[model samples]
Target: MKTLLRLSFAAIFAALVGCATPQVPVPLDQSFYTADKKTVGLMLEAPKAPGLALEGNIGLLDYAIIAAATSSLTDHIEGQDLGEFLAVAEELSQNLENEGFELVRLQVPEKAPKLAKFKDPDGKDTTYFAAKDHRTLADQYQVDYLLKLTATRAGLARPYYGFIPTDAPRAVFNVHGEMIDMSSNQLLWYSDIAHSAYATGEWDEGPSFPGLTNTYYVVMNKAKQDVLGALAKRESATGTLALNDDEEAEATESSETPAESQQ
Candidate 1:
């Protein structure tokens, strides 16, 4: 009887181990190019604006604000909330500056009033006030172009039991951005980029968190680069044609027509 019991326990352990799955690795796909290849004004959206919604959440700014407020004082993630949208905007602005592009700073007002309360996991109400101040800042800065970006998770799977704490079959992120011509109130450019990464284990508070994964940055940078690149490409193409036209005109003048030569 004792031997049989031991055998059963061993079999169960083996089965659980066999069922474990390996974590999936994330991928990065990034590119930048211009369509017109011309120099144009580039302005970054205000970080304070409640933009870039994720999973029905208020937006990146709201998330950052919440994260900063809730984080332990000693934690690195703590402090004033800049939100994801603003963080990305700042990064892109720096990148554009480094590349020698003309950058315009715009201050667009927030469309929605700051929320007075938020739903916590424990069904408690959490009050927020910083958002109100940020909204005011957005209104003060009148920007020429508004760049709106949104991030959403399409799917999440349960974790496997054995080797790893979690194993998602697939994780998808939909990233999209729109360039709004504030003057015309029209969308001048819009594009969406989707990418998938495998989650090997349950996400923990660390560098490996899905949010920290470079995949998000890859998609965002590509989107930004795409806008600037198109403008740059257009300019390059136009300049080349202009130069060629000038050369041809000079050649024609040098080879005077017979009637003009006779004179």
Candidate 2:
């Protein structure tokens, strides 16, 4: 029986490893830092309305049931004030200003469309946007680089294995930012910030899930830190610009620290 259990768990782990999403990190161009004067167009998307996302292979009936059970919790989460999270833009803008870049806010008439993703030459799906297409925005803004921050979602993520819950629901924040060179429409830097904090106590406190609510804010702050950390400049001992891959890894590790239960 133990051997059977071990094999079953191993198969599940293998399946998860096989199904993991592909990510290609592009480091920030060193030329931006070297340039005497830099102008950047900043486009930040409005944060997505909050709610619970049921992930994993859930059946139709199970999804409905989960939704029904979490309706109140969802509403409570949706009504949360995102002022703190929204302020991240200001913080990011200040960071750019400190780096000696003149920041230009690019206003969009409507929310930007979901970033178009496609498989790369290696057939792996990538988050990088289509090249040369954003030149129009750059031309209009008259900036050397475009810094786009996409706040995809802020809420809870409930992963499941069919009808069974794999773990406790987690308050989550998902955002991704990128820097593009307008001259060549090449991706210079990419940061995918995703942070989740599990509730300290029971997750299903109806009406007002205080513990989960608090955790939500904690995760949001972590996400914000990740965005800033990714943008922070780091140089190697040899005075050469370092790749952000290590910083991204460190951010992931820090964001994983478990949250203490809050009342």
Candidate 3:
């Protein structure tokens, strides 16, 4: 009878142990870019989606189940929420335009609603969200290039423990953009940009989940600058400037000055 009771208690304990397991969030893919060399029309695709989950527990395991759980703990593990992505996209578009790229804003299908409601981190009420569908928004904007972006993991870091101190929370982002020839549907150029930053604790309070998302917009903006820099460098190397014919004519004259002088 005692053995039977012990077995039942063990089963209950095992169930509780399973419930106590920690589940770390899955990370998202970084953003990248692609384009056709001839037309220089760019197409950007966001990295694969990221999900919110507990930190450091990538493989969730309960403390009771393991004889000795790893001494390390993660500060905060969470995915980049939708609000963050929208802000990033806006910044990225502006950055591309500033860099002399004609970006077309892709719209979701007309039949579908422009904005959809989603749950925020607080889990209070539904909030509006948007996506880049390409078909609907393309007509409204006159663009030779299209840019798309996805938000991967925003904040990630190891947790602080007596045995192992936690590292700074780093922000990871993946962004891809491509330039395609509108007529030929050929790829001209593309770039895959990824970035990571250590958590300074300034964005959030004590590694809590609330403010982790705030850093996403800032990181994405930085990423835009990075992508722009890359494109600018590529443009400089290829001599396929984004300037109009008038500008090209002037550039040609400028290049002839030394030759004319030598002659």
| Superposed model 1: Cα runs more than 4 Å off | 1-87, 98-140, 154-167, 199-263
Number of clashes recorded per candidate: 19, 0, 42
TM-score of each: 0.33, 0.71, 0.39
Which should have the higher lDDT, number 2 or number 3?
Answer: 2
lDDT of 1 at 55: 25
TM-score pick, better of 2 and 3: 2
How much lDDT does each candidate structure score?
A: 0.36, 0.69, 0.39
User: Candidate 3 on 1-263: residue-level lDDT in tens?
Assistant: 23223333554665688775332221111111233321122333343334221233221223222213321112233234434445545554554555444444565333743623332234243221112233343344445434434333333333333323255444555565554333322233444556655444554454344444444444555565555444442243474545547646865775675321000
Q: Summarize candidate 2's per-residue lDDT along 19-52 as a digit string, tens digits.
A: 7554467666565676776798888775446667
Can you rank all candidates by lDDT, best first?
Answer: 2, 3, 1
The worst-scoring run of ten residues by lDDT in candidate 3 lies at 23-32
Model 3 clashes, total count: 42
- The pairs that clash in candidate 2 are none
Top TM-score prediction, candidate number: 2
C-alpha displacement of 249 in model 3, angstroms? 28
lDDT of 1 by residue, 89-127 (tens): 555565545444444544333565453432223424321
